[model samples]
Target: MLRILFCLLLAAPALAAPPAEGPSPLWGMLQVIFGLLLVLAAIVGIAWLFRRFSMGSMLGRFQPARVVSGVMVGPHERVVIVELAEEWLVLGVTSRNVNLLKTMPKPAGHDAGQPAANPPFAQWLAAAMDKARKRQGDGDK
Candidate 1:
């Protein structure tokens, strides 16, 4: 019984070697971090490209640029618009009572301070109504 107990104790130590395959925990975590960083860089690059293109267009047309103003925003929504060149760009707007009007595709010499054709509330309501009507029609069909 004494000899058997000694043998069991010796065998336990043989099974204590650390794993020696694949990446360590630290390496795995580093890889995940690097991947995230790469993704972020790509997003930034794409955004830069878009900005450059938009700016180029504005410069090409030599249009006077203006900023959007007096807009309101809501908690559950955001608005984004890129006008010709850089005439008026309203990004992440959350106004419940805002309207968007059409502008000349080409650059205009003057600031055409026209209201947007569709207001935020009207657009949202119209979209919702259209969706509801479509759903009702589908049900009937």
Candidate 2:
């Protein structure tokens, strides 16, 4: 019985599961931080590319040339009238390009002092809704 007890004690140590070997907590944290840094770098790279590609249009907005008005012609195209010291340029703006469609002398009536270039969207929407309601009322009558 003494011999059997000693054997069982020795076997017990061998039978128990070995401690799980895994990356240390510090190493795991470092990997997470590195992954975060990679994502941050990618974001910054994309922003830089966007800014570089769009610099042409942005330059006019910042420089002596001022954007008088702009309207969207399509999902990815726009018509913009830019004002300079002497002349106004009509520009056709696309996703990756800007073209001068026309250039004309600044109109005598159009100057620095002007009301809001466009009416508030909310007011426009309200006006349309009223028109619709009037039409519906007329139809019912």
Candidate 3:
């Protein structure tokens, strides 16, 4: 056992490459670290390009339907108004069924020159957040 251990210990230095074989160990280590960083930077750049450009044409050119508004009528039910082409569909949505309540031409405000009644997503989100904040403040009182 001692002979085996001693032989293994003597062989350890031989397992490593000679000092003149390649670049310095520090330089090799730095190359590997920089290579890893370069690959990670490339991945992040590609992701940013995809996220920035991927959805622009698709969403801008083809918006088939838009939900104009919705209101909850029950714990598990809602009444939604959706705009499709030139029509507005009033829908009653329950957990089990989606019933069409009415259909009408798009509202007068949507005449290309005027903005529609439904606010943009950012505005709606801000308003919803504001309401939530107000509710939270009220609760604290």
Best-matching candidate per TM-score: 3
Check candidate 3 and list the clashing pairs.
Answer: none
Q: What does candidate 1's lDDT look like per residue over 1-141, in tens digits?
A: 999999999998787887679888999999999999999999999999999999989776854544433333356555545464645554444435544643335345534575454476457656866998999999998
Q: How accurate is candidate 3 locally (lDDT)?
A: 0.80
TM-score of each: 0.32, 0.38, 0.47
Q: What is the C-alpha lDDT of each candidate?
A: 0.64, 0.80, 0.80
Q: What would the per-residue lDDT of candidate 2 be over residues 61-96, giving only the tens digit for each residue? A: 746677887766589987777888868887889999
Candidate 3, residues 1-141, lDDT tens digits: the string is 999999999999999878776778999999999999999999999999998898775767867788877766579987777888889887889999999988899866665433355446346545866999999999999
Give candidate 1's whole-model lDDT: 0.64
- How many clashes (backbone N, Cα, C below 3 Å) per candidate? 10, 0, 0
By lDDT rank, best first, the candidates go 3, 2, 1
State how far residue 99 of model 3 sits from its true place (Å).
7.0
